[model samples]
Target: MPRHDHASLFIPPALTRRRLLGGALAAAAVGATPGASVFAQAAYPTRPVSLLVPFPPGSATDAIARALAPQVSKALGQQLVVENRPGAAGTMATGIVAQSKTPDGYQIAIAPATVFKVPHMQKVPYEPLKDLTYIMGFSGYTFALVVPESSPWKTFQEFIAYAKANPGKINVGTSGAASTGHAATMRLAQRTGADLNHIPFKGGSEVLQAFIGGHINAVLDGGWAQVEKQGKGRVLLAFTAKRMPRLPDVPTAIELGIQHVARSPIGLVGPKGMDPAVVKTIHDAFKGALSDPTYRRYLETYDLEDAYLSGADWYALAQKMWVDERKILEELDMLPK
Candidate 1:
């Protein structure tokens, strides 16, 4: 028998290299196939979902979130947790939501209308319309220009006249710069040529305190339904298009001949690129909760009015409002310097 060379006994060099290359390509194709990850992404909210609030525990946003959490959980069959991360005119929570992972549907936020105002007043990391998906609108509070019961200005017109005559001397307290209260006050001033001073506070409670202590001439605030009824303060005017039923005698801004209306509405949102299915599920659950007797009673107790909108409708409204607000702020020169 002739001695066989090892190289000759083996497969050809080109064939060996080709076989290895083909095996590696086949393994890569198997690993890269879109199956498990795609399926996992499709079945979202496999665990608890977080609903972030930019206000403190007892705030209106917090109240609504907590009130609806159970209903939402029941509908979704997942734990819906309320997480408070309040600060920076709601920027703290908004920023967290903005920077969170997108399209995962794990993190959602209850954002105030102030989220739009914040970017105009200060440096914010996210664009209000572009960075988040507006899931749906739930509720809104009626705003009022309130003063201590014994204060001199008895009517909205009287207050406007006083501010017009006093120019920058009349001071008012608000939740913060570019807050709904501040914007409403500014719009009032712009429309009437009143030069009232603005004092920004951290929250509504502080705004209320400032007015009660006589630290400020007036407070521009929402949720005045409870405060007005408490008798600590009197509403001069409802800063809305229509007068609140509870404050029937109190004229609305529009009724007072002012072309401005302000309401601090809140809606659920998630990071941009949220899955349409997840968005629909969240919207439907919250919309149902909004109609639930328990939640409706909570709204009545708080004197809040229901303002519902679908995800697409809410998103469109947000976009349009930002444009309208920017124009108003620009006219008043209230846009950040």
Candidate 2:
């Protein structure tokens, strides 16, 4: 208002699930007659719900979805089938959900922050705000810049200074060119007048591999802390609001005079015209899932932040983010190609 809907406030009894849901469908269909998408909410989720996770299985978003699946299934009284459609920086899966012909709330997706930014980068099959039913946001990732322990730079300051001096000589690795990590790094370069080159990989695991192998000078990723703790690398800076307990010795980018923090917010969504009653049911189920101790602990273990926002709130935020990130895309020459 992200996953566990703004502290579960009472939505006034007048806004009952059925009434609110039916009313939304009626408004969206723009006809006096009831449509399939409108009336389907009355007895929603009768069968298995398909959850399309854009990244590969075992990825961060995939882990979160699996963690939430059982809890949501118990609450909804139905099985949640998580389908992995990893490609095109998560846009492939997004397009699948967008093109779903089912009027029922069976098709849904959990995507990264890039869902809101990718359209500005190039042509995509669906529009973010207009094509999807905005569901609750789950959690946000904790990103960091890490280098192999053998690198010449010891701290974030030294790395930045070196990059500023060397310009495009240094290479930074991320998931993809227009992904959140890449955008944040581009923004940082704009703010700092640095010209470090960025190398895009298919996913974080690939980027981590490249970073550890010295194929890239440094890597900006969400999984760096885990690798750093394993003695494989060292995090020069955390892109979080506060210092993580496990890495107290490392400072945040904000502390180093950088104002932007790049965190990938993960969440669920559905095809356009999903019944509001169905939306409420799914939202409540996911909220129940997020409240589970195991899920919360899993998130904490990875230093990810709880960014729960309600359906209405998340929808509003999506619209605003779409508008807000245009400037960043333009600044990075990422508005197209």
Candidate 3:
């Protein structure tokens, strides 16, 4: 059966009566757990919870996870230790959490859109719908199309014109192949008929290093903050729905006649089948951590907003993304043969 021709291939048509009853019975079984086990569920994270960051320490995702860990730990009466496990554009750690036999709330990872979209593009170790438990969404990155300060193209239009005229001469760098930055760059190329050569690195720091060393013409990433701060690059366009407040002078993709916005939000998730009680405990703690002044200040520093969503809502969005990403990848000819 073709996966993209119909949504039914991905979404179940309807819940059968037997399946509904089975769900109810499963809930009853959870309710039927011994009082001691139930109490233990309420007292989740008696030990430190290890929060996995699927990127390097200097990356934006790692910074966000570290910023919230201490406050979430305070709320839960347990420490939240952040561990970096960077590889495959964040799939390495995400796959670890997904393939783990343990569903205890003690181990969770920060999930990005790649968690949903990557599985559609290639064979991954885990399934997005069945292998991971969506926890709570907290924040998003501010992505931009940045070029070196010495580049002659001052505006996005000039850059696009140059890319179109020169074809593959425009070497663009991103965190990794099939990353949100790569996807957005490809979308822009498709929209503007520009032939861009995409160079993928393991993380944003590497991409920045390469861009600064004149190895690439530009990079699409959140690390634009560091580049712009140091006056090493000029931000020509923001891959967002609206003009970023901090970069009000910079036009958005939409304003530049490209009808695309990079909606790459970040969230938390654990292995599937986590106890509902424990899920709630972690969710509530992180939800409260959203208000932490330090985390909020981090958001302000990076031109991001507090994009919070409940677990159920995040799961629903992932379902939509599963279908949407297949279409996007198919259009880009990125799906594995």
Superposing all C-alpha atoms, what RMSD in Å does each candidate have to the true structure? 13.8, 6.6, 7.0
Tens-digit lDDT string for candidate 3 (171-280): 99988888888888888898999999999988777888899999999999866687777889999999898888778899999987887677777788887666656776
User: How well does each candidate superpose onto the true structure, as a TM-score?
Assistant: 0.80, 0.82, 0.85
lDDT values of the candidates?
0.71, 0.74, 0.77
What tens digits encode model 1's per-residue C-alpha lDDT throughout 247-319?
7898888876777778567888777655445666677677777767777776876678788866656766776
**TM-score of candidate 2 to 2 decimals:** 0.82
Ranking by lDDT: 3, 2, 1
By TM-score, how accurate is candidate 3? 0.85
User: What's the residue-level lDDT of 233 in candidate 1?
Assistant: 83
lDDT, candidate 2, 1-337, per-residue tens: 0122111223455567876566665333321111224442346678899988877665666667788889988888999988887777766677787677664778888867788788787777767766677777778788888888888889887888999888788899987768888887876787778888988877776787888788999888775655676777888888878887777898988887887667577777777666666777788788878888878876865667788877766766676677777766776677855
Better of 1 and 3 by TM-score: 3
lDDT for model 3: 0.77
Q: Point out the worst 10-residue segment of candidate 1 by lDDT.
A: 31-40
